[model samples]
Target: LDPASGRWIEDKLPIYDFETLDDFERLKIFEKPLLAALSRKSFIGDVLGKPANERLYGSLAAAAIAVYKGAHIIRTHDVPETSDVVKLSGALRSRTSVVKEGRYEVSVLEVKTPQDAGIAMRNIGATKTGSEVMQEKSIHLVLKIKNLTTTEALIIKQEMLARGGDAALARDAVSHETETTDVLVMGTLLQFGRLARKLDGQARSLPLIAEMIRECISNRTNLEYRYLR
Candidate 1:
């Protein structure tokens, strides 16, 4: 043991093949130095691009390491969820992002149930009144629904036009047209939230929201949204 660095350095060990996690665990326990070589960096995660809540386990491990390493700052979306553990360990600290908020208009175009979506938008507004900003844009909605019959699809189209949302249909000549909705929409961010809130009730709708929003940004269209999935 060297007193300068306060550690023992092991020189030899076989790298484990990751055919099985159990073998990796055994190798770490029996062969690799478990605790002696550890520091704050021990808990660094390899979780690039994972959605926020999915990183909870890694976040917990990371917080533990933070406490171990005397960390003063951690930026994450699941703040309230992680704060409890950090508090119990006496590592809680206060911080908030300080930046000027930007303004944008959102158009809410196609939603399964528009009324319910409105409720969710209201709830979000109430929850983040001061720190967040939102604007609603008036617009048209066009949809190309796949599963609907001719008559039922027409009814939905009529409803959208009556409600000021433009609704389109799948092209008749194209082979792949029947599989997806062809919607033309224009709206602001708040309207998009209203539409999203309408669809937010179902578990599978989250990806729809993410995809639509992603398209909206990537395409840079006043067209607002295009929901394929």
Candidate 2:
């Protein structure tokens, strides 16, 4: 509905497929509250030249989109039907829990972060602390150490490989060309913990580097960005 014109915006109808929820995905970065009122009374019948009672399918489509786009509230004339759509769309949007194939059920788990891994572990009856620690093992991080001496870069790569992780350094580092190289350290939280501990016992700026790595991960885990309207 266009408030300025006091008329319905035909393009806003979900059946027309003009309005999209693409921006809603990016909107999550802002973390603002959203409320959507999607109901059977969207005036879609008028656009289709049909009766009011025949808009059930259009309403269901719109309601599915609302749920998938993170609507806080969904107003609907058909409560039970809309509720089912909400559940299905919400499940698909968040994660695909299960699929059936050849008389076998496959459970699909999405674990991009430690939080996601923790949830997955808990669902399988893991203890809370156990899940927490295991979740860290499930999460891998890559940190770039910039402006490092060739020796430091070589040491970093060797140490990471020793810990079952890996690091990439510039060619200059391997050739000992007296040039500083940036090292990309890749490891799970568990491997990183081991690396940091090992670095702590080493000499010459390695302890400080370990502390810096820990602090970097800590800050990332706790950081939250807020925006004012």
Candidate 3:
């Protein structure tokens, strides 16, 4: 409706126009059973009557439960607090060790025996241990390639998927719905390393793209370990 023209507009329709309580109630019909169950619980309404701090505690508990139940990307007005809850919940749930500092600090060095030297030698192996660790970890990477045909994108995607990783062409590129000329490659460090090696001897622009990917990986690894001061 245009207030300036004093005209009732009919061209655009509201997707969700809840004019009355009845309209809103109709939307909640599907969740009526769950709502009924919650209503039966006195604790639920009791918690709702509390002050902001108490309400926030309740909300944090709900958020933790949701995260434990496999929810990701929780939307919250209290970003910092909710982030702490989620991080704590994830740490409690997952087996992976959470690194407090980005890099470990060597406060003291007690190299008293030959075994300690051997341990150090093992730690500093011939190959880059950092790269090896990155490969072993379930790392995910997204690479965007521009100015590529659908066929070329599919070839890359197929190669990546065959090597236990996954890749995809831009949504429109697959069905030719639109003129999208890009490919998105997803893989771990090892899979990407293998792909780059395979691409090295290939003809045309593949080798170029491969080199670009290698450079990106190298830069990422360098950035990751740059905090080891």
Candidate 4:
């Protein structure tokens, strides 16, 4: 790594393939923090014909995307602004919370799947059966659903909220001013499963929605090979 820029300076310095970088799971293999650099002198600034001093917003936007793409540390000249961007971007990537009092501490864990929760539970010597049951409840997911009837969106929001989860619906859906609205559903695997099962018994297009939710969860958990078949 170059000390001046905190990035590798090699023969291919001019070309950075961010999409390729994002696709690779370096953290899973090396257990090392990935540091990403966002600079005013980057190609983005060049494309905008902006000087270093005038590229702050572009750099901040890059930094936020970097965080969402799994960069643990962001190397940027603008510390205060970048810090806010990082925090917000990270929150969007996953919901996290922390609490500390004296020597006791509790925090919401970030697990990508039930398998990840199972591994963590095993490490802590939790019972296999108990772990298997709790694992599905431990991981959270956020799914954005598009093109739903306003009534469907409103029902989804109410159902999710009643199930200890939540759904964000467009304001027009709540006000019944729009025919269709988009919704963002947030819940654990167990809650989602329950929601799908409940929706299966509901009238209208809800049975179809239930099927879609089941397919979504299955696809998410096995995306690497789901398309191969």
Best by TM-score: 4
TM-scores, all models, native as reference: 0.23, 0.54, 0.38, 0.55
The collision pairs in model 3 are none
Better structure of 1 and 2 per lDDT: 2
lDDT by residue (tens digit), candidate 4, 115-159: 767777877789889889999898788988999998888888888
Over 58-162, each residue of candidate 3 has an lDDT whose tens digit, in order, gives: 556655654543344455546788889888766665432334566764332223222333344455462355434443334557888888766667668878988
Per-residue error for 15 in candidate 3, Å, reads: 53
Q: What is the TM-score of candidate 1?
A: 0.23
lDDT of 1 by residue, 18-55 (tens): 11111212222122232211122212222234544356
Scanning candidate 3 in windows of ten residues, the lowest lDDT window is 33-42
* Model 2 per-residue lDDT tens digits across residues 1-229: 1111111565553322223332233233233565555454544554456665888887787678767866656677789988899888888777447888898998744345677677767767899999887887887899999888787778878899998999998876798975788889999988898999988998878898999999887765342311111
Which segments of model 4 are wrong by more than 4 Å?
1-109, 223-229
Q: Residue 25 of model 4: what lDDT?
A: 31
* Worst window of 10 by summed lDDT in candidate 1: 13-22
- Between prediction 3 and prediction 4, the one with superior lDDT is 4
RMSD of each: 18.9, 12.2, 20.7, 9.3
Residue 196, candidate 4: alpha-carbon lDDT = 93
lDDT by candidate, in order shown = 0.38, 0.69, 0.53, 0.73
- The per-residue C-alpha lDDT of model 4 at residue 227 equals 29
lDDT of 1: 0.38
The deviation in Å at residue 48 for candidate 1 is: 32
